[model samples]
Target chain A: MHAIQQQYWAVRDYLSPVLKESKFKEHGRITPEEFVAAGDFLSYKFPVWTWEKGDASKARDYLPAEKQYLVTRGVPCLRRATSLAYTDADEDAERLLSFGDSSGTADEWVETHAGRGATVDSAANLGEIDDIPDLDGDGLASAMADVSIVSETGATVGETPDLDDIPDMEEEGLEDGEDEATMAPVVPKAGGVIDASQIGVANGNLLQVRTYDVMITYDKYYQTPRIWLLGYDENRTPLTPSQIFQDISADHALKTVTIEAFPHSSTLQAASVHPCKHASVMKKVIERMNAGVVEEQLAARKNSGKHQDKDGKKKWGFGRKGAKEEGVKSPVEEEEVEGMRVDFYLVVFLKFIASIVPTIEVDSTTAF
Target chain B: MPVVQFAPFASLVQPGFWHELTRMKIDVLRLSEDAITVNGSYSVGRSIRDRETGHDIALGCNLTVGEDAYQKAPQLSPMSVHTTGIFKNFNTIEDFKAADKAALINDVVSKIWDSIITTKDTSLLTQFLLITFADLKKYQYFYWFAFPAFVSKPAWQISENGWKQADEEIQGHFQLESIYDSLLKTTRSFFLVKEIGGITEVGSIEQYEEFFAGVAPENRVIGFLDPSALPENPGWPLRNLLTFLRAVYPSQTSSVRVLCWRDSERPTAGKPWRSRFGVVSIGEGDPTTKPSAIGWERHPTTNKLSARVADLAPMMDPKRLADQAV
Candidate 1:
């Protein structure tokens, strides 16, 4: 296995602080606007030099006459998406086979935990939040609390970040006559849009589009991530067949070929790459960025230690970047450099999706 | 042509391997660098609850292997089911192992486990079973220590008097975790033989036991003693394995199946084809009275042993087996 295969969660962990937290607000997800706001907030701490893909000279011939300026519009794009979570083929299979119908599972759980009074199905009717007081305080209570607390949060951009403080656990706060066996709060997935109108649209279009239409949904049978590339121009016009076919690389063009006789476009446009190496592209970007940090640290160390300093603590590279007050490097510089690194990572991802997809703009100014 | 249910005709089971496993990580015994192992420690996941016990089992030691394996002997290349053919030879599909067979394995297993008790719906049992059933059979015998069992109540329930006594004994036995540390053993299980006042001696008559022990009697456990050494008398191991199980307990208890496949001459063709067969043995006491006669029936479709895993749940209960009689 390549180094990147193992570094997926590590990279996700490294980028999670600024990119997205797994959950938010009683399972409430961050609105794209809110996610962008949080990204802005993090940018102040670890800023990336983000820019737009606007080079009229390098514009391809397929560019629409109306939206050709998307290249030259200079809309100040930073590679951003509201949220993403990774799952491999095995995990996807186990989850689907084990608990494909979550409602049935919930009914079973409620039946077991609450006995007959309220099933997990009916438990939802009892109230939004009900606390089944954990008498022993051993496993279920603490575990439910842990699951509830992990509501992948990406706060609305410009809004104060509430990522640190998990929403209050609604306890016996349930009114009398309510009995839900204390079902976890239902986290509304998707549908959070960043009103890019606030951020300013390019030309007449929303500079950013947050759409799951282009997601890499894992195919259970194939045991691969079947990437469905959205077929649309920046103007939202669906692309013709030839237009779609033109987007993919010759080597990966086999993805467009139909495997089954189904008339569905899903099989036609989507493709499966080697799952093990998919993350390598992202890892390559991080490696380059990490190297920049090391180089900075080395440069910093060399400048300070013309002579070997007596104190070993001073020579340590960690947290030493941008220690500017005493002319020492500070960690802030490393984060800033990392910011550029992440932006380039995003750029690489866009290029990758572009290679897989025939239509759809990769670099959007608004939060995806 | 059909997926064969191989036999344990040739296998390496270091009866003492389980004595070396623990909870920290997946460990292995470097048995001469090439021979195989048929026993190890398995653990349950953290969030799983036992149906018999209200919490998850701490660690499942003294576990057995080849219980879920069905392969054509150990190979240099791993028998893993991959996604879209990675690290494979570009030309031939010789090394190519598709997910269809794996998916079929899952499909069949799911059909049986469709009726799991809701009370024990947790990660421990489900996760452990998935990994055990899904992962390809590696020749190295790695990860003797699997995952833990999660259930509301453990498999074995203690009586009111035995409850406190069982708790104390569990703490004394595992040695790692005291009962105070939220993590607790599901049950302290042991294999029972005709008791010699708890002396570790081979009883004249074999009996089925659920309790744990160092040297268990043969009726409760069955594995290869050496390479391809099939008893001159056919079905000897199968007959011995089932003597204690079929004599008592439900058919589900006898679900622990062992798979063995070896290269042998064809019955008439004389050309070499993979000869595969399995023994569906149920435990019954010494068959001297019952006449250790085992009947074999052909499966309707494929070449299957009598034990067809249809419409049944996986019997993943931890076990303690009796050693072979000297």
Candidate 2:
């Protein structure tokens, strides 16, 4: 196993007892395929500052010297971990089903389904995965007959199936009835859930149940993660667009981007939608892009001779002399004007997702 | 010694009237050969009568002689009768006729003889004559007799029995003459003449000059000479007599000196005398004195007596007296 995989298991084992005391039910353990898939997702979405072997000095020389190095580096890692923990792909379906059964009620069926392992990606493909083929090719005629009977009984009784019947095919249609009434399917989009269980199979590893009761316990210790992307219009007036897209696109370079997360109780699916991780990476990329854009704008103005004084002096007017001395350059003209030159800007993006599972068991006899 | 007698020598002067009166029925004898008998007499005749019988009353009368009878008698002696016989009146002739004439005559005769003969001795008669003459020299005849009469009565008496007894005893032995002598002695011996001249020796040539020196020339010294001492104008001699009297008997004549000069000059201006002799005489037994007049009288003369003091020294100018040395 990879060293990072071992660390993940250790952290999981350490937190498992605490989670169990808090009534977190785990159906099984996580498969190695899931860990790799989660790692891939984190790597793509939350990249760290990279340097060549000798480039450490170069990068250090290039980047602005700041006192808080960990704040600039380790914060990205932590944010990434937090987001992955809330990802819907990390949910355990069987655990959610068992949770539903222990709850002993059916009124929350729709909410339970929504909170389960189904992601936007899997939800959209519900139509293709709706029909399950039997294990033997006898069409599972008796099991289908029992499922039809249980379905009929569930329609009549509006209650969960018996716990003993859940493994039997008789309770299948009973659970199916509840799913059809509550969970409306979704269409898949890009950058959606990537199934890590499949990776375990391809790697010829024995399949683990992959049940993880990832409870995103929140307290004042964990603050809400939010991203604030500051931009300006052509008039140099500050702009805060309520529409997230507009805020991201309005400025080619974001001036000030920050991400913050609130304290909350959520599943890993909810945490995965947190924008803190995305916000950290996008901040650096946006800074470079904005620096280029502003420099271009400043150059264009210079070329056009738009900013000039009446005395025909080039007016780097942002930090210029006072009106009394038309030609005399003030000290601010060198320091402030030079400093305010568009070196960089930043932009932040954030997403958080939480997965919740509620499992229900319907009694096949109750359907009649 | 054989009694060989010589005839008397006759004087140039004839018997005076006093000699003729004193010689009546009296014999003069020379007791010794050298003795001169110039006969003089003093005859005192008094009539006696029985008041109730209205008849001539006679008692045996005789003349007894003294040795110095004639010489002691003054030339102008006056006769004086002093009667001491008592008479009782019956208020009726029958009652007088009824009385025993022989016994009455004997009684009358013995009493008259006893009264007359009692003063017949020589010394007694001499003293009588001397006293009578001295009195006559000082006062009138009436005063000489009246003074004895006035003084003989008790002048004052105490009403209390005890004090009355004492007064009686005092009167029984009292001698007015001795009292007079004491008064004179007290007066004259220290008689600080309240009068100016009486205070010092005065009326002599020396004292006279001193007195006149104290007077202004315009002022005269009027000497009041007594007329009885005629022809002599006896100023100094009389004053010497008074001094002799005071010296001989200070108490009898000391008061006499002041009484004699009581009305004399007072020593200051506006009076009869000027500051004569400048001597102040104080009346010593002036009831003002014997408790002692020295302090009271001397204080007045030395301090309060105002005198027209004159400078008597020949060398002192009269202006000096007016200069008010005080």
Candidate 3:
């Protein structure tokens, strides 16, 4: 098992008391698998979600807090850390991952090794590391050997980590064997409507899958439903940030968009957070979701038989579970309409976020 | 000397908002799947959502005098429909940061500060008076209002002349009313009234009460006070009327919230600073010269400006008072 996988399990183990101690399961513990599945489901349901890829080889990149966990549990390959999953136009599409600028590269990883009480430069750190009598042969020694190589180049830690054809910061490369020009806007020929079905993403790198479950609750103030996700990959593997960053559409990346908050209620006195440019893609995505098949289906449902109850009451969509409305269509149709407002947004949000992560369906995803 | 200053006004609003928000203790407010907590209590930052249209709106911070900061009641700007979801719906920090720095910070601060209000147990008592600032076409001014937390918000409904579309059935005229109506039931939180315009003067207290019947008597009342209209002594007629109403029905009237906004550069006082518009709050500026004042009033129910004359008459009456005494 990868170190993070073990650590994740360990973390879950630690929370076992809180998870199982309470009289209710809601306060109790869930298996690690359950958490991963929930996180995966949530990543697909919300507009604001990132599939994180933590690099185990770059173990130094793990925060000081997470490092002790990494060391004890053995290292994990967290290549999926903070990444997103995407699918091409295929209905049975394989998920490709798009990674973001995550943690340390080769040098930083090497530096982190040095930071572990080495208190010295390349050779000294190496010498000090060697002083430890229990060098487990080529295992720790092998990974450490890469650090010496990282130190020799010092200047180029310069060669840049082999990005594995990950899209560069410019996001100009096409790894999915598609025409480079396709990356540009498709420029809809039919009015302002975009056929979401036609949109396809490159599988530059396959995203490692994890199982997770979703728990939802409302925010106290915003009155907007906030989705809470939990879970991690089964193998406990993590992804390189570039694997995720490479998949981000040029528009949604930082610098193309921003969310501003006004000081008073006035937009004019608004304060902008993190000075990065941001894209205005949410509305456009919603428009596409709105102009899709869902609207037609809702309209059809409204017209076909389920119009009003015998008492002449307009059928309100919101209701508790097991609520019967003149036996409307079926249990499925009623839920579709009732959850239409939130679900439609989630569906489109799934697609938009997919543009940010690579979509790879490794066997690990299904097996788990 | 004038009491308020402006350079810090840009930043002061956040702390001021937090200060006001600390008083609210809501139980639960669900946007959809997410439940947010404020001041250690479940609360919702109220905004409107249209289920069918997918259109949404949020309460804009009233910039009239920073009245939103003063009364803590915000309303959406006239052009805000276009900018609603990005701030509230962003699920990722990266996505949030990409939207707009100010907006992202605003959103983050709003989210992170939900339950961070300190428990200063000083004034846990419910305050009924609230003053909010607002803006209209070309008007920007203060609004004094009173809507206690115990009153339920009124819902909108349709009456007669209900229009039907295609296969949909037509009910009644789409008149605004509360969804669940019950003037008698007690509410958990205070009701909030959101009016569009800034500030304006009324002919009399009776006319004021009648014209703004949308604001129920149970809720806290706020108004856009125009102290300039008062005579030499100005007799604080509005405050007096509220005090009288409170004396008649102590359960409804508890406290009053006052807000003032004006251009400080006038010959009025101390060296002026730059501001789009300035606000003078109770604890903020120099009260000596700018004078944050409060007075009282009481008269029999037979008075012309009696709240009973208005449509939103309190449940109390002289007969009830006499019966209680007996």
Candidate 4:
């Protein structure tokens, strides 16, 4: 962003009001305490995730000790979203499957590409890989010490590793049975190095997979859980911001994904999914899930040989919108959705996030 | 048979490790840059492996620590072999860069060598060194890890039969459950497995002097809970173990059978857990001569001998701190 804009944001962030009361049920926004509660539930449900007390110097007093943010490591992204057959020719699929209303047209979307005002490969394609001078052990320390590595632009220009020659991990214990678990992505070549005939033939030998260390922190301004991703290539080398963008769905890649500082750690600048519309999307998801629960309960009652007319006056757990066909009447939809505990907010939030980055097999939380 | 090449131990530093280091710098040691003993754990399973390549899908070895890393007595996990490492936090980036890396490596390697001759402590085989510079103000940590492995004149090789997955019959004879139970009960990563008639028994590496005294050279079976997923080669810890073994018994080098113990968290019923057996051949070694060693983790992206930087200012910046609180 522009220097003035960044400065304005810093001032605004510093002056942002603290949310004291919970508006989780009404606006889908949560307080810091509720964020911790949701985070706790997420960690309890998925043991892969754990709460970490970040740098003590930057510790926030509002959050509990040892519970600054949530993190799950080595979340495998087997294939690039663009390389997957399901997503290769399907730009409209991302829109149709979006958790938000589908009424918004593609043209209405304004791309918020990261590093726009910055100097980190602002071009569409990574043209010439910058020769990031190889500094030996001692030189690297002194070299990096002089630079302002904290700035978003400074981080991108720091160490852009050669994307080509992605080292293949040793090949001794490979069994044929794991083929089902691994996906084959068209290995990214150095600037259209391979032609059509050599599409899969040239780079077909090895499976190029990426692993992500996903971090979730509460965005106080947005009052929603914002996710930040630190991705590593197949060889465990840090992926460049552009390389990381390949794994994100194209629709969200241009619009939502932006390079920003991870809250818990100031030194790391990771690609974060913007939380501008998190509450709206979450509100819709909560309603849909509530409706689904009502359907299941209605179906169960019908299968249980219960007479609906006898219990006509009985209050149903859900509202009467979808219940008309089942001949069951209940309270308002708002009351039915109130049953959703705020603790499951993150779990439901991830359900929609799966659409944004479908290639990342991160949300394996018991099918939600 | 193919000559066995050990897969280098890939350093996996959990973010918590850095956080704990930051806490130690601020709360415990303000300006002093002394070497503190820390712990790192790695498991045989949980490796993402490619079916085609005997190599692990990612770099192997998760040398990680958690919040309780610096606890007076850190609790060890049953699934992994916990190894003690030296953590040296430098006061400045210049000091970290100018630090005697070669001397640092030699120091740890000598410790392993000394333990081999004097104490015969097998845990020293996995001794590692971690050097770092934590820029607490900026919240960026520059660190490098070295898992020192002693070099042999003639590297260890697999026998003509090569390494093979132990069959159900061999598994039955060895008693997999007993070994698994023994591993859970002790912190010893290296152990001796002696099968008398049909009963299998597991003992600590410290008892190697007495445990294998009467056993024939051919019957000497050394089993380690290997952290690498590769079936062909064992993890890096085996290097020093073999070196120590060679120093102790140079005559019986060819007769030792190595059982690379690999365990899985979710074991499929009717299917045997991943484990391999191989006969290793190591050349004669002089205890007098200090063996050469090499193992310093490199920056993956830069591919240079560079220290890794973890920026944590977003969580620590005063403005950001005030933003979260107010």
**DockQ, candidate 3, vs. native dimer:** 0.01
Number of clashing residue pairs in every model?
74, 72, 139, 19
Which candidate number would show the highest lDDT if scored against the true structure? 4
| TM-score of structure candidate 2 | 0.12
Consecutive 10-residue window with the lowest summed lDDT within model 4 chain A: A174-183
lDDT of 4 by residue, A208-301 (tens): 5567888888777787888888776555445545456667765676468766656665444577898888877666666655555455455445
Question: Residue-wise lDDT of candidate 1 within A1-368, one digit each (tens)?
Answer: 22243245335533443313322221222222332333333233222211111223433232222222111111111111111111242123111111113445321100011111122243342242122222124232233233222212432111223221222211121122311211111211222211221111221221222111232322222222224442332222222222233343332333332111011211122212333333433343334434554555555455654432333233322111211122123442343332222222223333344433312333231111
Q: Please provide, for model 1 over B65-179, each residue's C-alpha lDDT reduced to its tens digit, 9 standing for 90 to 100.
A: 2211212231111111101000011111111122122332233224223322222121111112111111111111111111111111101111222112111322222211221
**Tens-digit lDDT track for model 3 on B280-322?**
1122221112111110000111111101001000001222112
Please say which candidate is ahead in lDDT: 1 or 3. Answer: 1
lDDT of 3 by residue, A59-84 (tens): 22212312111000111111232221
Give a tens-digit lDDT track for model 2, residues A178-247. 1111111121222322112121232222111111111111111111122222221111111111111121
- What's the lDDT for residue B79 in model 3? 15
Candidate 4 lDDT tens digits, B63-129: 6555556765554445567788888999987788778887888889888888888886787788889
| Alpha-carbon runs more than 4 Å astray in model 1 | A1-281, A284-368, B1-72, B75-168, B173-288, B291-326
What is the descending lDDT order? Answer: 4, 1, 3, 2
lDDT of 2 by residue, B1-326 (tens): 11111111100111111122123212332111121223222222111221112221111111112222344342211121111211222223234324333343334334322332343211111111010110111111100000000000101111122111111222222222232233333322112111232222223222333444554322222221111111111111123223222333344333221111211111123222111111112134322111100000001112221111111111111221112111
Error of 3 at A279 (Å): 12
